[model samples]
Structures are given as structure tokens and as C-alpha cells.
Target: MNAMRLRALLLASLLALGAFAQAPARGGALPPPLPLFPLDNWWNADITHAPVDPNSAAFITYLGAGRGMHPDFGGDSGDPSAPIYGMPYVIVASSQPLVPVTFDYDDESDYAAPGRTPGYPIPNEAKSQQRWIEGGLAGGDADADGDRHMLIVDRDLRILYELYALHWTGSRWEAGSGAIFPLDSNARRPDGWTSADAAGLAILPGLIRYDEVYGPDPIRHAFRVTVRHTNGYVFPASHRAGNTSGALPMGARLRLKASVDLSRFPEPMRKIFQAMKTYGLLVADNGTDLYVTGTYDTRWDNDVLNPAFGAIKGSDFEVVQLGWQPSRSDNRRRSVRH
Candidate 1:
């Protein structure tokens, strides 16, 4: 072949290879559309810094103590009328089993009340689980100030999560607006999968779904799980700014660490996770007051994931209508209506 022709052919081959590598993966048949939970208004009061108030009391009551029996034991509380504000509960990693750790604002006198039992027991099975290899306190205590913090340990006995329920005290925003905190540290697992890695992998995709300016938003809710990749390369632009409309960039790759176990999941979940080998992320944004997003790609039907993840129907996971902007006056009127 002529030199010019040979060079042209080589260039063309490289371009084709690049295009093929970048193309979106197509399975034999696309998996059935996953179910979603939708969010309500996106512009509520910035409760992140709001203070504890009557509303905060009610919110905590609903989440912590429950309506009657069968209370959701995950909240930290501060008052009796369910007034004032604090996390209803916090989970900390503990080496010892069965004894509940208390994190209250009132001193030891408060815990010494007549009928108040101070601690709870850890399950025997949980003690034998491999995740709690290095268990620690899963609860918290108040600091010099009255603000309360909560802690949680992952199955691996690692102190992987912490939550600071209400920190701002005696302020109007102090009731509902303390920081909902998370851990800043990272730990390495034997098979990869550090805590930070899991959180990043689980949360990033949902962040992408919410922030992406293009087409209809894919998420209905904000609660989600992100799986991390050990060998993947994040797109420079996507990392700095965000992803563009339609699809991801050409060289984007999400690599996973070795320790994730996907053995007993349903067929659909398995298929989705395997396919994620190519895409590396799966996001579900059910529309509601709560939002969930994550990094791991699993194929369970919407039925399974929603219940397991505390996602509600209709409001918990529904797609957001993009490009439908209301006028300022209209928004003001809508706010009044609410």
C-alpha cells in the first residue's frame, strides 16, 4: 500500500476502536425499568442549619419513637413531649455485645430515672458476624454544649458512620437545623472496599442524577448507594464540574474494589451489577421528601430495593420533570399555597 494510504487507514482504525470502546453497553434485553421513589419540593427551608423547634420535635418523634410500638430505634432524642431537638438514635461500633450506650444531654441523673432502662443488648448472631471484627460504641454523648452526636458501625466492626443530629443550640434554627453529619475518615478492608470508597461510590451517581442539567432527571428520590471502583478513572470535567447531557464522556471508567459480595442477590440485581462492570454505577432517585443514591450496581426489582432501602412509593421515587421552570411570581404563589 502507498505510505499516505497506510497512514490514513491506521488513523481510521484507531478512531473506530475508540468509538466502539466508548459506546454504551447493550445487553441482550434491557432490564425491566426499576421502580423509583420521588421527592416533593426541592426548595424547602434549608433545614441543614435550622434550629430545633416544635416542628423539629414532631419530626424527631415521628422518626425515633414511632406512632406507638415498633419504634424505629435509630433516632436520638432530647426531651419528653418529643419537644426540643436531637437525633432519635445513633449506632456506634462496639466490641462488647448487648449493652446500650446512652448519649443524652441531661447528666447521669436523667438516665437514673425510675423506669428508664439505659441500655439494650446486641444480638448473639450479630456478634458472630464477620463485619463487627473491631466493634466500638455505636452511640454518642453530648459535648460541653447540649448538642448530641450519634455513631454507627458497619458490619465489618469498623467505625464507618457518624451523625451530628442538632448542634446549633438555643437558636430558632437550632431545632431542625443542626448538621446531619457523616464520617470524614476512610478505612481499608481486606478485599478493598473502604468506608469512604463505599460512601463515595454509593452517593456520587445520585449527585450526578440530581445535578445533571440535561434531559429529565433519572432519580425520584435522593437516597442511593454508590459502589467504588479500584481501577477506574473519573472524567476530569465530570469530577470538577459535572456530566453533560445525554451520556457520559468517552473514557470514563468506574473500577470496583475486590471485597463486594453479590452471590445471593436476585437475577435482575445480579445482571445489573454485572452490567455495571461496563458502566460502574447505578442510581435510583425515587421522588419524595427523602432522596437516596448509591454507587453499586445491583439488579433487584424495585419492589425489593425500595422496601430494603426505606424508600416510599409514589413520593419516594419518581423522575423530576426537567426544563419546566415556573416564573418567580408563580413560585411565590405556590409557596403560599403550601
Candidate 2:
């Protein structure tokens, strides 16, 4: 072939390689940010106009109105081996092997359920990958008291598996409780059933993912939040983790008051606060008051994240009415996108 023809062929080959490199990973690699569940799902609901609970003031007081909003995720501490300050998740393909998971709360867990594939789609790497669980304990440290949450997404099957207090035995996997969620549907856990989260809610939907936080689009869903105390759970939250009178319940939604100004914050931080105004926060567990959960990512700068979130206090939020739902007409209007 002529030299000119050979050059053209080489360029074509390079172009093809570039396209392949840009393509998404084939073995269940994460796709670009999309709606986790349906748009009408509670997590994605537009609750800006939702009714404020009559007990909003009392609940906020119980949760310490003066307490600041805390970002419970970000860059590492000095120790490289210590688990990062956020929950971690993994994605797997449909062909990923499913393993039987023994659960302490077997009745509530979905193990061997009809719709679910016989076992959890937990990857083998979870046994060796330190980042698979909350505490960053890989195959060792089976007795840690931390929540040890393990969240796995089956990208091809559109399924979510979440395990609370997960531990790996030399021969098998065990957990305190396990829950499976269908990502494409908005189904709640059976009434009074606890999932991987205390609220019986899907943890992935409410978490602030790294990609979503730094992406071009705004975060369009509610965030998973924690409080020092909770009284029974309300609608959308399937289980009640506590009964502290006058305290907020699991599944309670807190909207950032519109009056809270974002002008002084940087653009990225502003998008986060803006999401609070729109989708609000859902109380999912018992922990420090006003702490929000996010995925583990080293790219996070806690120095910037900490102060920015700390500026807002619990008083800046209002609790929505218990079991609030958009009107039929409103749902129809907002149902256009996921």
C-alpha cells in the first residue's frame, strides 16, 4: 500500500480504539447519573411545596435546632488503611455469581425470595476488597461493631442488594439483615420490614454519590440523613427503629427553608444545598443529628465540604407532614421524567 494509504489506515485504527476506550465498562460498570428509582418515587419527589408537619418545631427542637448540618463523607484521614468516612458500594453484571447470605433477621430479609435470584449478587472481591463495606474491613475484623453496610447494584438486572452489619466468615457470608430492591420500581419493603437501613428504605437511592455531586446535572433526589434519636417510623419508612416521643421518625423529610441563602457558598456546594431545598432529607438511621451520608471517594475535599455544610443548622430545615404525598394532578405533572 502507498504511504498515504497506510497513514490513513493507522488513523482509522486509532479512532476505533478511542471510541472503545470511551465506552462504558462491559461487566456492570456504572452508567452516567440517571434517576435511581422512578421520578414519582419518594426519593425523587419535588417536595418544595409539601406541607410542613404540625409538629415540625417540636421535632427540630428535639433534634437540637442549633446542631449544624454535617457532611458525613469526604477525603481520607492520615491513615491510608483506615476506611474512608463514607459508605461504599459496588456494581456487578447479571452473570455475577450469587451467594447465599445467612441473616440474623431472617424473617425480614429477602434471602431465597421468589422474585429475587436465589442469592445475593455479592462479588468475590468483597472478601478481599477493603472498600466494599462501611468500615473498610475486607476479609478480616469480623467482629467490628460498625454498621458494616454493603450495597451492591446489579447493573444489568437493575437490582439493588443491601446488607447491614455484614461480615464474611471464612466459609460464607452473614449479616444482621438484608434487603433487596428493584431499581426500576418504587416498591417499599413489606410494612414494618427493616431493610439494610433502619428505615427499611433503599440506601442507594438516598445516598449522595460522587459522580452526581461533581457532575454537570444537579442532584435531583433526597439524601439519606441520620439523627441522634427517632420516634416510630412514618410512611415510606417500613420499620420503626425507635419510639422517642416528640422526636422525628424514620422516613421523616426535612426541607431546607427557601429563605436560607446560598449566594455566599461556592457553586458545587450550592448545588448540594439547592438539592436539599428541592428533594429534602430523609431520616434513615440513628446517628449524630443532621449528618448526611455519601459514597466513599478520595476526590472529596472535606476541608471545603465540612465548613460549607456546617454553616447550615438543623433550624434551617422544616419537617414535612407525616405521610405527605403530592396530589393526583401534581403527580401526573411531575411524572414526565425519571
Best by TM-score: 2
Model 2 whole-model lDDT (C-alpha atoms): 0.83
TM-score of 2: 0.89
Candidate 1 minimal-lDDT segment of 10 residues: 172-181
Return the lDDT, model 2, position 116.
57
TM-score of 1: 0.19
lDDT (0 to 1) per candidate: 0.24, 0.83
Please give, for residues 226-304, the per-residue lDDT of candidate 2 as tens digits: 9988899888899998998888889999999999999999888999999999999999999999999987777888888
Query: In candidate 2, residue 326 scores what lDDT?
Result: 68
* Span of ten consecutive residues with least summed lDDT in model 2: 23-32
Q: Clashes in model 2: which pairs?
A: none
Off by over 4 Å in 1: 1-5, 25-47, 65-292, 298-338
Which candidate number would show the highest lDDT if scored against the true structure?
Answer: 2
- lDDT digits (tens) for residues 239-330 of candidate 1: 11123333222112221212334465544333333322212222211112222232111121345444433422111111112212224453
